[model samples]
Target: MKTVAAIALYSFREAVRNKILYSILFFAILLILLSVVLGSASVHQDSRFLLDIGLFSINLFGDIIAIFLGITSVFQEIERKTLYNVLSKPIDRATYFLGKFGGIAMTLAVQLLLMAAALSATLLLRGGSVDLQLLGAFWLTYVESVMIASFALFCGSFSTPYVSGFITLGVWLIGRLVQELAAFLDKVEEPASRHLLQGIVALAPDLNFFTITTQLTYGYPVGLAYFGAVTLYGLGYIVVAMGAAIFIFRRRDFI
Candidate 1:
């Protein structure tokens, strides 16, 4: 546990130092601020429009940051020939992998918090109030980013960071449109095609479940029960991805 904790802290510091993280975060905040300007153009739906755009900006950038950190966490070490030194320590491979993902999760949390704060401040400046509905959306967005990070770690186990990041980003894009895939399933005329698509969709996580932005924009809050369900789903997916990452990393040759 202590080993994991130490590695996690080290990884967090390293992740924070990545200049790309700051660049993306700066743009995310700028978009959040832009939402306010754009919202003013709406006749009576400025709040709704602003909330939607603001949350969308935060979630989209958060996921990208997750992918970047998660995919590179392992590969960067190898690139610098530092993995050899780290592995020479008493750290177990599985423990080290968890620590990397934990660190990425921590970094993402900080990123999201900053964006959320910015969004809230922007709202306040626009004569709007932060509400529990917004918080719920933020919570789900955090969980979604963490889950994607775990998946990215799993992908990084056997591939270069660039390949892993592409794979992770592709999967994330598809998963975000899980609902559309489901809708398209019925349009397939062939039974085999339908079944294959259905199976693929089943394997992909429904990212829509992690989103409550529409409801928030409509002034409705999701119940605690809904939050529990999605949180459980996210945690379950994280466990599966992390376990796979550990399994793959143990057999990975760092040379």
Candidate 2:
């Protein structure tokens, strides 16, 4: 456990030092700040506009960061031939994978908070309170990003970083549009084809479960129980995905 923690801290430090991460975070905060100007254009709904823009900025860039970290974390190690040395230590492959994922998750959570805080601060400037719905929405998005991170790590375990990033982003897009895919499922008349599509959708992460944008936008209520459920779901998905990544990593011949 200490070994994993050590590796995780190392990874967190390494990731935070990446110039690209800071660049992306800067843009994300910039977009949120831009909301202040854009929000003013709308008459009497500056808060709502800011909310919309801020949420969009955080969620979009958060996913990008998640994918970026997952793709680069282990791949960089292998590329620099450091993975061989790391694996040569007493730690098993599973420990290394878990540590990497933990570090990625930690880095993402911190970045999410930074973005979320920027949004909240902007909202306060616009006379909007940092309400529960907004927080819930942000939490859900982070949960969604965490799932994507785990999935990208799993992909990077077997494929090149380019392929892993592409596949991860593709899956994320499909997952986000899961509602549209479900509506299309009703259009299919053939049972076999419909079932196949259904299976694919079922196997895919239900990102819609984490979406509360409409509710947040409209000032609808979101309960604590729902937040608990969503949090648990995200944690569960990460565990399963990390297990698969470890399974694949263990089988790889890194010689």
Candidate 3:
């Protein structure tokens, strides 16, 4: 546990020093601020527009940081031959993998907190009130980002960084549309194709379930039961992905 914590802290420090991470965070905050300006153009719907833009900025930028950093975390270590030194140490592959993931997750949590704070401040300035529902929406967004980070880690475990990034992005895109794809599959006349599509859809993540920005914006009722279910789903996927990554990393031969 101590070793894992050390590695996690190392990863956190490394990620903090990444210029790209700062650049992306800067732009995300800039967009959140720009939302205020854009929202002001609307007469009565300014608050709604501002909330929408702020939430979207957080979600979009958070995902970008997760995917980029997650894909490269282990791969960069291997490419630079730093992984060999780490592996030669007392730490096992599973602990190392978990530490790396925990570090990235920690980084995402910090960035998400900042963005959520910005959103709340923006809302307060606009005469809009912050409530539990709004915070719940941000929590779900963080859940989605965590799931994406795990997916990226899994991809990076067995493939080159570029390929991992592509596959991670593909998974995200497909996951977002999994429900629509399932509906389309049901309409297909061909039985074989329908079954194939069904199998694919079953394996894909249900990201649509995490999206509650519209409900948050409109002040719609998002039940606690539903939120708990989606949070569990995201956490389940993260566990599965991390498990696979550890298994793969243990067996991988860095020649």
How does each model score on TM-score?
0.97, 0.96, 0.96
lDDT of 2 by residue, 97-202 (tens): 9899889989999999999999998889879989778888988989888899999999999999999999999889888887788889999999999998898687
Off by over 4 Å in 2: 190-192
Encode model 3's per-residue lDDT on 1-255: one tens digit a residue. 998898889999888889999899999999989988998898899889988898889998999999998999999999999999999988789999999998898899998999889889989988998988888888999999989999999999999889999999999999988989988985898989988888879999988788788897788989999889999999999999999999999999987
Clashing pairs in model 3, backbone N/Cα/C closer than 3 A: none
RMSD of 1: 1.1
Question: Model 1: which residue pairs collide?
Answer: none
* Predicted model with the maximum TM-score: 1
lDDT tens digits by residue: candidate 1, 1-255 = 988998899999999998999999999999988887889999987888888999999999999999998888898898999889989998889989888888998999999999999999888888788987788889999999999999999999988888899899888988989899989987899999999888979999999999898888887768999998999999999999999999989998877
Q: How far out, in Å, is residue 98 in model 2? A: 0.5
